[model samples]
Target chain A: MIEGIATLATLGFTLGLFLALAARFLKVEADPIVDDITAMLPGSNCGQCGFAGCGQAAEAMAEGTATLDICPPGGKGLIENLAARLGVDWDFSNSTTNTVPMLAYVQEATCIGCTRCFKACPTDAIIGAPKQMHSVIDSACNGCTLCIDVCPTECLQMVEVKTTLTNWRWNKPLPLAQLPLAA
Target chain B: MPKLSIRGGVHPDEHKLTNEITITRVPTPERLYLPLKQHIGAPAAPDKVIHEIIHKGQIIARAQGSVSANIHAPCSGYVEQITDWAAPHPSGLPTRTMVLVNDGRELRDDVSTPVNPLFLRPEVIAERVSQAGIVGLGGATFPSAVKLTLGQSRNTPVLIINGCECEPYLTCDDRLMQERTQAVMDGIQLLAQALYGPDTIIAIERNKPEAIRLMEIACKDFGNIRVMAVPTRYPMGSEKQLIEYITGRQVPAGKLSADIGVTLHNISTAYAISNAVRHGKPLTHRIVTVAGDAVKRPGNYEVPIGMLISDLLAFCGLKEEPQRILMGGPMMGQALPHAEIPITKGCNGVLAMSRAEVKNSTEHPCIRCASCVDACPIGLSPLTMAAMLKKDKLDQAVDIGLKDCILCGSCSFACPSAIPLVHYFNYGKGELLIRGQQQQKDDEIKRLIQGRQVRMAQQEKEKEEMIAKRMQAIAKRKAAEKAAAEQNSEKEIA
Candidate 1:
């Protein structure tokens, strides 16, 4: 019985060694970019990029299949992170460049008081019901511009809310100013 | 009740009253202000001379690159002024613009059939689209040609048409479906032909039964295409959401719909495609929904691109001075500083609101009600993210999955506290980006400084070595000279 046990252990060890050797021989070169791109991402599986999750987004980024500006919910932060990590330049101006933060508003009176739009909103930004005036959840709007297209009463509109000092953040400067800001 | 969601999104009240009256084209304004940069990507450089007489559909601005869209004269008019003006920007900053004084001729002289896209290759089709200034009229304003190219290169299997106008107070698309059904479908057919054969699907919200019925009927004859009614949801009209909802497949982040063998085009874009292809017309005008509580006459108008918001409001018979003038739908729209800004390709709706509608509710602290979380379609904790962002700990926010946020406004909409959670995210994102840029610059500088120091040290070492070798050679020569002198003296003595 002891001899049989020894034989079994030997067989297991031999099989393990063979598997390890096969793995080494079959190794395909992995693109190191996957790790870099993954690190750049928010790591949240929000599926905001139309993907299944953030990990999938990272994979796509490594594959060069998606644009760096694909994340709308991530907004400018994601774009900047991606640009920095990928060593790419990105224009972020609002007039002609990407990364302008936008909000959504609903036309209240014209809303027909139907909850169709409320139901259609993925973010539940609209608050009202059938036979009641609907209002926009202004703070939560992602500015994806999806909701503006579906209103039966033509009540939904994507108006850019004015960016005041209350909501303003200092813009990122050109690369010449490499020093970190004083906290 | 817990609201349903599928992906990144927000719900805003759809104030569509301004457009609910009926469809009417505002009488041509005395002057039309056309912005040189109307579409997405780079703005086209003005090609025409400052005062050169231009007609409708005349290419005033040509596409500069693959990402840029073209710009055309909306009506026959003379360039009155070419100057910078406050555009409809969140920052309320002025941008370069072109103002035109309308001759009220409504002239469209430059009309002719271009090379038929059907007979031409896909590449030719793309070129014509580029020339037509065609963009995704669905508010994205992305160049149609680029989308087409992306689809062709990746061999996208299915084309999804977005018909989910879920935002409140905007019914331009809905009306377009109701009124221009045939034109829209024709546009869809052209898009399909341009893309992968006729394997197309029209994704309409179940709420728009009429639109669904019309689209279904229109597409019935086209065996390769069909209409699909997605469950009505805010941001359901989003490309990612619609794609996932329809195909049950999620397009990975950092990837495109084409990567998953799918491509999406707006119904309006399809219409533009048809207009550009069949009518041989450049994208000069589109259907805009003018809606709000303040306007006496509200409805959809086939307004030309670059028309001012003031003219539109006046033409509609201003019932009251609006408290807010918004471009696009309320949920995802932007509030205009005033009505001076001209319309662009991405403008789909204009809303005028009374003081009452614009009044802000008193904001309160969060009660930990978990309402925002419940309302979030992508299933995110808005309260936590907002708190982290408030503390200026963007990295921690990111650690909590900040990248996954869709900014759909559901949380804010559901928040009883009236906290601008989405705005906070935007702020946090902006701050984070600034920090990232600074970090990148620092790293680059460090690399350069290190390289310079290393080179300087190497040069110093080389100089010292050269001096030492020279001194040694000189000493050897002196010693040889002394030896030779001594030998000469000895010879003389002998």
Candidate 2:
């Protein structure tokens, strides 16, 4: 029992020493603020921010290599939040323009029932069997536009989503003096 | 005795002042404004041209889709205009309307000869009902022909005629049952005949003893027909609750009454159906209960469809300046911004309530008292749903049975804190729908980008293959030339 205990202690000590050495050699000194910035991003990995992904964008921002308002999908809201969180002075005018929300529609007349677009969809929003017409599950889609380039028949087209009565909000009324004259 | 009841409901004050009054037929108005979208589905497409003279009961607009119902002119007149007007919706948005100016002469288009419903096939009865443009008069306004077809297809065994005018201020159904009892029974029999001999049952709330007694006496001759008075409950008129109370069967969520071998029709709808099948008349008029404290005359009136609310209120004698003008019962009715909106088939009551009747209490935060939970008929967690919706977490709200809500307004009425639960649920539903549309658009953009990448990669592969083939061909030509030159040298040396 004593010999077994000694061997276990020695093994634990040796492993601990080896781990300490490896940690010193291979440790990646990352800024803690990078993770905070990454959390603030949309995490869609759309690459519209001119980086490999959201993670790289966050890293570039932390290192001062990239500006605060590079994400088009994030819009003004993200820029404001990021600037406030990072304590940086960001020019509101230099922010990337927001892209309008669009939905992909398959032009059935031109579609050859090719399943290539369906296979390329990352969100599993496009549904169909081989050689069958595919339809997008609009609720599940993240607006990535990954499936369009793979469509062999060039049948897919992006359309701006229409606002329905249910989703329509009352617009803020202008001041009485600024209102247009009655026709 | 345990009262025959559904799971959860609230008993509001029953202000039924017009229950005893007989229905009075109103004189045809000078003008009638009919909104094309009286029913739930797509609005009917207008076929009549402007300035065209049309007779009473003439088809002004055709049904746009299978789910839509036709719109008929209520009075013989010239089509003044086909324009957008304030519709009888909660939003009060402008919808396509047919404006007809009544020409004093009540000339109705000739209807076909009435056929005995007994000999006619079920399909023929359904077609006749559809042609009459009859819809559910119980405030749902779903096309009655669709419900009849569904009942026939499902082979429903029981036909429940709902005479339970359970809404507090609505008494048109009660008055109809008390006065025209035979007509309502005949309508039920006709509906049963259309559904291939289903057992007919007439259900009336216990609050209206006279209606119950009259209906019982009317159905005594028919051996298969039964008239039962259910306990007076706020929403016993709800098809699901009524079906459960009478049949002792709970309709599964998302399924219709026909799915459970039962068909439910409102008593007013049955009355209309009987009129259409036996009398060869179309549904151009309905008994509207014009009641509220603000009105001088509070009673049921046989008002022609497309009559404006303002005209009805004037005819009823507005006692004081009306504080609120509701299109239906106070519980489920929409409070109109103005009284110019016209009445439709679904409008059973128009309450021009005074300030005293309108609760002007400020909404308070929910105290988690579970009063709404107790009042919810569908047994949903209104508190949790409201909390999630408040945080703009619509997906989480929907995950916890948001779609199952019937918008009965019980939760709002029963809340001690007055949280406006129904409004929160409606807002959540609308936001979720918008999110769904946005997601679809996002998916489309992703698909386009992916397609472009694939096309570019294919082109690159093709270009690489072409260059490799050309390089191989040039190498083969050079090897052939070197071999030929070496052979020539050897021959010259020899």
Candidate 3:
């Protein structure tokens, strides 16, 4: 029993020393997950997720401090993806954030030839000359609200995306509980 | 070649109510709402301004892209308006539609005289077919011209005509085969020649012995054409399934039958092609089986493309308020919200079912009986896929052959639990599509953002450079002015 214990102790000591050396000498400088998350993110750096940027948001997400759904721009797909990656059982069906996709609409009539909104736009969705009324390209606008805050004229507003034949999809089937009882 | 049997299938009660009924005709309605996107690919685009008059057989909207069909006026009518209107879909959403008001006179324009299509070259025939805007009437709605071109390009060795109206409560194809045998045969012969004299087989379901008999009689003179009576199984009419049953071959996933040196066309499509080539007729009308218990007159009707379902039902007469109204066959048909939807080129059946006909069972949890597995014609695991979907693992489900699903509804029909397996699949497919669209939008946004970032940086750099250049020029001008002033002052001092 003494010999067995001595041999085990020696092996443990040697292994522990090797692990310590490896930890010290071969330590990773950055979390690989942060980079992966940054790649998946919108990369717009719109700061709508309450973080300084997507990189910071990814850092917080990696550290488990930020929920996957914290970024509105990422949408439900991102949440599900992140949940899957992190091995979390995210019940997306019951999620309250069934937010209708919003598009930045420009109130052209009220807009005073201010280039501030365009300057703040991350996607260059706004188009106009410096002193001319600006218009947002519906397709390109990310609805980040950065332009909204910077808009001195308050011309930019988030409008729910109107359903067109191209963009519209079949409504999801109602759950059994939600389905009305047969007459 | 070894026979690749149908992977999985279900035997639903073949409610061939209108199988023996002769084809009938319905009068033109007051207003016909024709949708732009009746066929697959890009929707037919109208170049006319609002209120423009369109005559019968006039090309109101031309096919925009390679894989599209032209939309012709079924009746001489003035354009009422082009606006979003109800579509014959389950979603009940409005799509871009051209409303035409019938003037009671069907004045056709540019009616071409008959030319023997057999004398024409294959490419010429293809051009005429594309101009006629004929699509597969087998509910697939693939552009017939495009399919012909594909067959020609692939050097197809066999041509299989799909006469299997395997869907329950739909007998439009059967009726067409029984009535228009010669035209369909001519179409088959013409198609065979266009496809470089490929061996032709008209595959009809054994259930429709009449269609089979008629087709066989018509194929007597054609040495290459043969009428085949295949098993009357559900989805036996599917191009892949029919090819498998007759040719003993399997069309690889993500590939057409042409890839395997074969081409398949529907019976209705063949008839349409015959009409288009012989009479120079555009695809403006189709035989629709208006059946089910609720319909007063359960028979097949040759319906105008833009005619409203309400008008058709008014002519047929409904016995009572239908519990469910479907635009196609009951098995794979869409449950339409109302009867205001207009008929399209692809629609084959208009079923107004009662509660008894529609066996709406309470959805029960899967019993893990694997009935769904047995019923899937594509041999996909509907149960396991559903489980993955429940876990929100859509990508995982896709990995396990979700893309091959044909939405045949055989699994749901086979399920004893009435679990609505097809509904789950529909949901999954829609979710995947939506997710794909979202991914595309995200990618587009990312590109735009990156481009904007680069542009902003370039603009800033340019602005800085412009400012520095202006400052240098101002300083140089000031130095030159000072030198001139100093020279003038020195002159005065001298």
Docking class of 3: acceptable
User: Tens digits of per-residue lDDT for model 3 on B1-494?
Assistant: 42444668877898897888889988888998999998889988986668998888888888988988998888887998999999777876898899999998888877764568888788877888898889889998889999999988988999988888889889998988888888888888778878888999888878998888888888899888998877768888877777887878788989878888888898888888888888888888999999888989989999999898889988999898889999998889999989999999999999999878778688776789999998888888999987776666788889988888888999888988787777777778887887888888888999988888888889999999999999999999999999999999999999
lDDT by residue (A1-183, candidate 3, tens digit) is: 999999999999999999999999999899888898897888888887889999999999999998777777778777867887777877765776644677888898898878888888888888888778889898787667788888887888988888765666655445545556479
DockQ of each: 0.04, 0.06, 0.31
Which regions of candidate 2 deviate over 4 angstroms? A1-183, B1-3, B437-494
The DockQ leader among the candidates is 3
Q: What is the lDDT of residue B442 in candidate 3?
A: 85
Off by over 4 Å in 3: A1-28, A85-87, A93-99, A129-133, A170-183, B1-5
- TM agreement with the true structure for every prediction: 0.66, 0.71, 0.92
Residue-level lDDT for B291 in candidate 2: 90
- Two-chain complex of model 1, DockQ on C-alpha atoms against the true structure: 0.04
What is the DockQ score, from 0 to 1, of model 3? 0.31
lDDT by residue (B300-378, candidate 2, tens digit) is 9999999999998899998899999999998888888899999999999999999888897666666899999999988
lDDT of 1 by residue, A45-163 (tens): 34657888666887887677987777654566667567667776656543233455556677766778867766555454568877988887765455555566667767777665565
Clashes of 1: 76
Per-residue alpha-carbon lDDT of model 1 for B32-128, expressed as tens digits? Answer: 7777676677878887877889887888877787699778887887887778777766665666678877888878875766555566566767777
Across residues A89-136, which tens digit of lDDT does each residue of candidate 2 receive? 566445456545556778888887779987776556688888788888
